[model samples]
Target: MRTPHVVVVMGVAGTGKTTIGPLLAGRLGVPYAEGDDFHPQANIDKMAAGIPLGDEDRRPWLDAIGAWAHGRAGLGGVVSSSALKRAYRDRLRAAAPGVVFVHLTGDRELIEDRMAQRQGHFMPTALLDSQFATLQPLEADERGVAVDVSGSPEQIAARAAAALDGLDATAPDAIAPDTTAQAGPSPL
Candidate 1:
């Protein structure tokens, strides 16, 4: 039997991580985890007040998500996280060594527009800039793929599924090439 990998659907706040995560999880027949649920109330309050969380503020949240990811390792699960920095991703990898990322990429205007349309979300549109500023694209060595957010959630999830399908998830150092271009138009 093939080993199943835990997928982390990652990107900036408004790039649709929440929407696509469950879709991808459904496609893969795995459970889904909402990363924001891992955040403490304090962190939500901070972001709600337009404050960007510092590394110290994020560590606990990341660890919480990591712990969940660790628990789901090999069992196959999908989780969502902004995972905007290399260090944050590294922290996740430390806890769940085989977790693969599905980065949702899109233009700022598009993301901002989507953020405005969304309701009852604690993350304010004001924090979008900070999210983009903090984002670090996955490196060549990273075992993941970047999918463009230009299409519908179903389309985006389909693209991610296709990209992930091509990856050798069992390989310790499987490198998922940047498939953003193939997924759709450049979101850069």
Candidate 2:
């Protein structure tokens, strides 16, 4: 059997984190969480009003997501977040040790086009520049894979799974010993 891995599907808005996260979790046979749901209503309202969130506004939200990830440390699960900065990723890592990140990346023009077409999302397309500016790609030492958002979600998830092939749980496969559920909160 193998220990379950916590996967964070991270990227800027419109990178399809929401769409791809659940599919990735399903592929991994784990639960899925929407990181956006972690944000307080105030944050949502701010974004809905076309206001970019300052770092202070994001701290509690980041902490909440980190705590959620921490709760799933030993079990496999997927969560989506716009983890756009190194400090943000560090905060998540601090809370959930060994959490692997799946960074969804793509060309600016392509992402903006997708954002322009999206509806009912709190994040405004106008803030796309700030997202790009804040983004810091995963470091070489990070346990993660950088996947291009150019492909379909299925393809992207497949690639991410493949990228994590050598990362099988140190303990045992989830199916072994009938321990499908490891240690973590129920899927959100």
Highest lDDT: give the candidate number: 1
Q: Write the per-residue lDDT of candidate 1 for residues 31-131, one digit (tens) a residue.
A: 99999999999999999999999998988898899889889976889999999998788778777777889999998999999999999999999999999
TM-score per prediction, in order, is 0.89, 0.86
lDDT of 2 at 79: 92
TM-score (C-alpha, index-matched) for candidate 2: 0.86
Question: Which has the greatest TM-score?
Answer: 1
lDDT of 2 by residue, 1-188 (tens): 14567889999899999998998888788889999999999999998888888888888888898888889877778899888887777777767766788999999999999999998888889989888888899987666788898988799878777766655543235422112223332221
lDDT value, candidate 2, whole model: 0.80
Give the residue spans of candidate 1 off by over 4 A.
Answer: 169-188
What C-alpha lDDT do the candidate models reach, one value each? 0.86, 0.80
Poorest stretch of ten by lDDT in candidate 2: 175-184
